[model samples]
Target: MSIVERMKNLSEKECPVDILRKEIAGSKCSDCGKCVFGYEGVTQLQMMLGDITEKKGKGTDLALMKELCALMKTQSLCEDGEDVADAVSYALAHHAQEFEAHVAKKGCAAGVCKKFMTYHILAENCTGCGDCLDACEEDAIAGKKRFIHVIDQKECIQCGACMDACDEDAIVRAGAVKPRCPKKPVPCKRK
Candidate 1:
């Protein structure tokens, strides 16, 4: 489905800004540079969207994007550019609050953006098998054998390798609200 369609049928897990950013990155509309409106407009959109997803968006970004999309809709040389412009316009018109949240440094409600997500090791599920510690290249996981591992949020890069390597399903990604976990490694309750 098109990005607009997906936005129209958005689920609780999907963020409109992130969805548009992914669509722009994956689409080839910006590959053609025959027209400045089509090429530079899409390029700017990509950069702006990237910044927004990374939590670096400015308060003025929405206004700037709207103006660019307007120009692309009318002046683009091809349908591809026009379609992308329409998708962005649709999202801006319908999901402006989502854009504002990211721009204002508020957490993503959908939790799809990596910059807004935090990885946590669930103490209840952790078996202290040491697999997660080995999988972590950042050394974010701290624990020894038979003890519940604790994740250092400052040191963590939010990579899912720890989650994948964990056979006990101890690691989880949290958004908005983080779970209560020990500040340091503790004895494992699960045997």
Candidate 2:
């Protein structure tokens, strides 16, 4: 197949949350305080991300995201908006562990999220079951049978597959090696 045939359309592939996030970020929010009480998922996510960026620690409130996304999915006027809600719902269902880590440890399993996570394996707890290795699509885990496994930080994408695979609960977030985003107050005035 040609590269053109294989290439997917950007709009068709864009994540709904990402679409809303981009729109929200590009605008100069008036801080009308409406979103805090509004029922829109995108707006809710916008408010949450804003609050998180403001260092308000609101990002830890995973429940709120779930609720807001639920509302959006059921009530949004447009499919685009509902897509954001569905994405959140999908994440909640399929990747609850990642969300729990964010709330409980301020870490992201997918290291793709800035300042959210840095994963490691606890050698003492690791039984070398090779579960993490099998789960790790990135090939980040390195170890032989009957020995402790080690995670290669450089190669790890923080996908958390290994964490789920580990029955021994040996995986842990070591904190960010280089924080992707600073947990600082939003650099804008809110009305």
Global lDDT scores for all candidate models: 0.88, 0.55
Measured against the true structure, the TM-scores of the candidates, in listed sequence, are: 0.88, 0.39
What would the per-residue lDDT of candidate 1 be over residues 80-155, giving only the tens digit for each residue?
7888899999999998888999999887888899888889999999988999999999998899998999998899
Question: Which candidate wins on lDDT?
Answer: 1
Off by over 4 Å in 1: 1-6, 26-28
Candidate 1 local lDDT, residue 110 = 89
> Candidate 2's residue-wise lDDT over 1-191, tens digit each?
21111222224433223333454444322233344222344555767654442223344566788787777666655554455555556655655664455445455443434344567776557666778989999977777666667777788876788888888887876544542321221222211
* Candidate 1 displacement at residue 26 in angstroms: 4.1
Worst 10 residues of 1 by lDDT: 1-10
Q: Which ten residues in a row have the lowest lDDT in candidate 2?
A: 182-191
